[model samples]
Target: MTDLKPRKMDFGFDDADVPFLWNPENPAWSSMSNAVSFLAVGFEKMIVKLIRQAKPLMTDPAVAEEAVAFMRQEGHHSTAHRQHVAALIRRYPGLQNTLDAVIGEYDLLTEATSINYRLAYTADLEATFTPVFKLMLDNEETLFRPGDDRVASLFLWHFVEEVEHRSSALILYKAVVGSELYRMRMAPSVFAHVLKVIRIACAGFNQHVPLGERKVDALSMFARHRAKQRVLTFFAPYLSKGPMPRAFDGLPIGEQLTALKGAALSQTPGHDPAHENLPVLADEWFRRYDAGDDCTRWYTAEPAASGANR
Candidate 1:
C-alpha cells in the first residue's frame, strides 16, 4: 500500500535549443536550477545504487516496499534530468566535463563511504526538499510560469513527486540504520558535500557558459560566493565572477526566511517531513495530473475546469 508510485515523464527536452537561461526573467534562478539538474542526475544515480545495497538490510516488509518505490521514483528523476542536462551539454559541449565531474563526485562517495553514512546523507538531504521546494513552488507565478514550459514542467513534476514521498528516505534510514543521532551528527558533513558538488557544477557553468547567456554569476546561489564577489568588486574587479544576484530576490523576505528556517530545522534530530507546511501547487499539480491536463507542458496545457476531480 505504499503511495510512492513512480510517474514517468518525458519533458521533450530533446526538442532543439534548450536555453541555459530557461527562465529569462530570473536568470539567477535559471542558473541555480540548471545546476540542480546536474546535481540530480548524479545524486539520484547514487540513490539507486545505495538503495540496492541497502535493500538487504531492510527488515520490515513495509520499509522494503517503500525503499523500492523510493528507488524507482529516484531512478525516473535521474533519467529525466539526464535528458535535461544532455540538452544543455549539446548546446554547450564543455558542459560534458561539468556533468562528468558532478557524477564523479557521487561515484567517489559511493565507493568511499559506508552504507550507514550514505543512508544518513540521503536522509539528511531528502528531509529538506519539502520546505525548499515549497518556497519555489509557492512562487511559481514568477519562478516557473514565466520560464520555458518544458523545463518548468519537468521541475514541477519532479518537485510534486518529491513531496509525495518526502519521508521515504528517512524512513528507510531509521529502519536500516536506526540512529537519529547519527543522522543529526552527520548533517554538517553531509551538507558540506552537497554544497561542494553544487559549487563545482556552478563553477563549471561560469567557466563554460558565456556571461551573455547565463546573465549572472553562476555561483550567485551561494551566499558566501556572493559576499566574496561583492568584496572583490571593489578591490579586485577582474578577480570577481560576473555580477552576483540572488535567485529569490523577488520573493518576499519573510517567505524566504521561513524556508531557510524550515531547511535548518529539517536537519535536527527528530524532524518529520510529514508535518512540514506543503506548497499549494503540489496538490494543484496532482489534481491537474490526475485530471489528464498534460503536466509535461504544464504552462501551455489548459487546466481542467474548476470542481474537476479524478
Candidate 2:
C-alpha cells in the first residue's frame, strides 16, 4: 500500500520575503500561478474537510489509510498557502480584500453543501490541478527557470507533493460513492468555479503589475496558452467517455514519486500520475529532495549565490 502519510516538510516561509511577481521575467504566468496558490489557501481546507467526511465511508482499508495521509498533506498545503497569502497581502496592497471576499463565498458554500457534492468537487479539482502542474513542471525551464528562490521553492515543493498524491481524493470518492453520472455532472461546475477564482486572482495580480512590464506579460500569457488547452485535454476523456475504472487505482507512494518525472511527459493510459514525467530540473530537484541533500537550493538556478545572499 502507498504510504499516504504526509511528511513534515517545513519549507520555512515565515521568515522569507518574496517579490510580488516572484517570477519577475514572466508576470502573466506569475499572476496565474500565484492565483492558484492563493486559491489553495482557502479551498484546501475544504479539501481536507471533504476528504475527512468521505474517509469514514470508505470500506477498503487501503483507501481509508490513503485518505488519512491525504488529509495530512492537504492540511499542510493549506497552512503553507495561508502563510504565503499573508505575505502576499503584505506585498500587494489590495490583495487581502480580494482574498477575503473569495473566502467568504467559499465559507458559505461549505456551510450549505453536502459532503457528496464537496467530495465530488474536490476530486474533480484535484484531477484538474494535477495536469496543470504537469504542464508547469514540463515547461519549468523557460517558464520558471528565473524566479525568486524562496517563492519558487514553495511552489515546487507543493507541486511535487501534488503529483505524489494526485489520486487520493478520487480513489476515496469512488470507493464511497462511485457514480459516473454524478462525477460527470459535477466536473463542469468544479472546473468553472476553479477558473472563476483563477481569473479573479489573476486580474488582481495583473492590476498590481507595473505598466512597463505589461507587454512582456502579454507575451508570456500567449506562451502559456497551451496550459489552458492541456487542462481541457486532461479532463476531456473523463467528461466524455466516462471516468476510467482504474483511474483512481494509483500506484504506491514510492512508485508514484519514482515515476513522476516520466509521468509528467506521457501519462500513458493505464498508468497515470505514475506514467507522467517532470521537467529535467524538477526531476533533479525531487532526486535531491528525496536524497536529503540541501534540496532547498532547488528553488534557485544559482544555489551558491542564493546561499551567500541569505
Candidate 3:
C-alpha cells in the first residue's frame, strides 16, 4: 500500500467561477466564468510542464506505465477544461486579451528555463487552485445545486485530480532540485490565492447581486459554496501528511510517485466517462490520466458563433 492518500475531494470555485452568460440574473458569475479563461491558460501550461517532467522519470517499465496513464488523464482534463473555457469565451468576447496576456506571461517565464522559477510557478498555481478544491470538499452537497452543476463539474474534477496526485510534483521537485524553501514558499502562496479568489467572487459579488433576483437565495448560495471552507477542508489531512518537520528520507521521486499512483488507483474509479464513471473524481484521474490508451489531442480553441451560448 502506498503511503500517499487521496486528499479530500472538493469544488474549488464559488459562484464567481460560474458565469451566467449575460443573464442579468447573476452578473458576477458571468464575470468570474469569463475571467477564469485567463486562469485556465496558466493551468494548461502547468499541465504541460508536469507531462514533460514525467517523461524522463518514467524509465522503469511499470513506473513508466503509470506515467503514461497520468498523461492521458491530464490530457483529457485539459481538453475538457479548455472546452469549458471555450464556452465562456463564446459568452464574453472581451476575455480574449485576458487569456492571451496570461499565456504570454507563461511564455515569458518559461523562456528563462530556471527550475526554481518553474517550481515557483508551479507552487503559485497549486496555491491558486487549493481554495477551489477546499470549497468542493467543504460543501459536497451544495455542489449538486441545479444551476451550478456544470461549473462545479469543471472546478471539482480539477480539484480532485489535484489531490489524487498531490504528492507527485512536490516529490519530483524535491528530488530534482533539493529545495525545502520551495515547499515553504508554496504553502503560503497556496493559502493566499485560495482566500482571495473566494472573497472577491463570493462576498464582493453577493453584496452587488441582491437576494430577490433568483429562484434560490443568492446569499445562501454564496455562504454554502465559499472558498474558505474548501481551502481548509483540503489542508486538513495534510496536517499529518508528515510530522511537523517532514522526515527527509531521500526517497526516490519515481518510486514515491508510483506508490502514490498505485494507492490512488486502488481508491479511485474508472477513467472513461463512457465506462462507469468513478465516484471519486480526482483519485481516479491521477491514477489513469497518463494511460497511453487514453491520451488525445488538445486543439486550439475557436470562438463559438454566439457570445450568449458560452
Candidate 4:
C-alpha cells in the first residue's frame, strides 16, 4: 500500500470569484432543486465544525487540519450556492411557495437533533454522500479531468478537494466511538431525510417553473438534454466496479446503493432545462442540504470483506 501522506488543506481559491451561477435559462423547477442541494450543504457545515474539535482528541493533528479544510470547502460551497439560489429566486418571482417547502425540510432537519446527533448525522452523511462524490468526478472525467485548462482545473478543484480532505469526520468517529458500525447504522438515517426533501422538491418542480403559453412536460424535459446519458455514464462505473468500496474508506453508501434511484429519482426521458427540474444552479443543487451532519464514525474500521475492494 502507498503510505498515506498528510495533505495540505486550503479553502483559499479563485473559485471564490467564479460567477455565482450558470445555466441562467434553466427552469424554475431547476432552481428549487438547486435550493435543496444548497440547503443540505449549508446545514452540513455546522456538523463539519463539530467534527474538527473531536478529531484531534481522537486522531493526530494532521487529521484535524484536514477536517477544517473539508469544512472550509463546504463553507465556500454554501456561500456560492446561497448566492445562486438568491439569484434564481429573483428571476422567478412566483416560485416562492415551493422554495419555502425545500427550506422547511432543511429547518426540520436542523431541529431534529443535538450537536452529538448532528455529528452522528455527518457520519451518516459521509456514508450517504461519499460515493456520489466519487461518481460526480467519474462523470466529470470525460468533460473535465485530464485536461490542462482552468475548466479541467475546476473539475479536480472539487475532486482533489474531495480527496484531500475526505477523511476528516471518519477519523474522528473512530476516536470517539471506535465502531465499524457507524458506517452501516448511519446510512439509512441520512437517506431517509435526504430522500424526503428530494421527493418534495421534485414533485413541486412544475409549480416553480414558468411556461409562456405551454406547460412543461416532465418526460419531455428530461429527454432533451442527454440527461439519461449523463446519469447512465456516471453510474455505469459504479455498477461495473467488481466489488463495493469498503465502508472503511469513508465513502458514502449512497454512492454504492444509488444512482439517486430512490432518493427521489425522476426520469424525464424527454426533458430539457426549460421544461425540467434540471438544476438551474448546479452548484446550489449540490451543497445546501447538510445541516450540521456528523461523520466522525465513518472511517474508523474495516468492513467484513477484509481488504477486498477498497
* Per-model C-alpha RMSD: 1.7, 10.6, 15.0, 16.1
The window of 10 residues in a row where model 3 has the poorest summed lDDT is 240-249
Best by lDDT: 1
Q: Which lDDT tens digits does candidate 2 get at residues 1-310?
A: 8655475555555677766667766655566567767788778877776776677788899888888888888888888777777787776667787787667656766888888888877776666456566656655654566887666766777887887787876777678877756866776777677766765665555466444433323212332444544465587733221111111122245534544544333222233344444345545655565555554446543444233321
Q: Count steric clashes of candidate 4.
A: 44
Question: What is the C-alpha lDDT profile of model 3 across 1-310, one tens digit per residue?
Answer: 2233323222223224434333233433333443444455555565567557645744445444444454555555556655655554454444444455555555655665465546544544443233344433333433322335555455555556655554444334444454556545544544454334433333322333333332222222233353444455477843221111111123345634544444333222221111222235344334433332121211112323332111
**Global lDDT of each candidate:** 0.92, 0.62, 0.42, 0.41
* Candidate 4 Cα misplacement greater than 4 A, ranges: 1-36, 48-60, 94-104, 128-130, 141-160, 211-310
lDDT of 1 by residue, 164-280 (tens): 999999999999898889999999999999999999999999999999999899999888888878887889887866878889999999999999999999998889998989999
Residue 33 miss distance in model 2 (angstroms): 1.2
208-248, model 4: which lDDT tens digit per residue?
54333113221222232235444554778532211111111
Please report, as a residue range, the 10-residue window in candidate 2 with the lowest summed lDDT.
240-249
Q: By lDDT, rank the candidates, best first.
A: 1, 2, 3, 4
Candidate 1 segments exceeding 4 Å error: 303-310
Model 3 whole-model lDDT (C-alpha atoms): 0.42
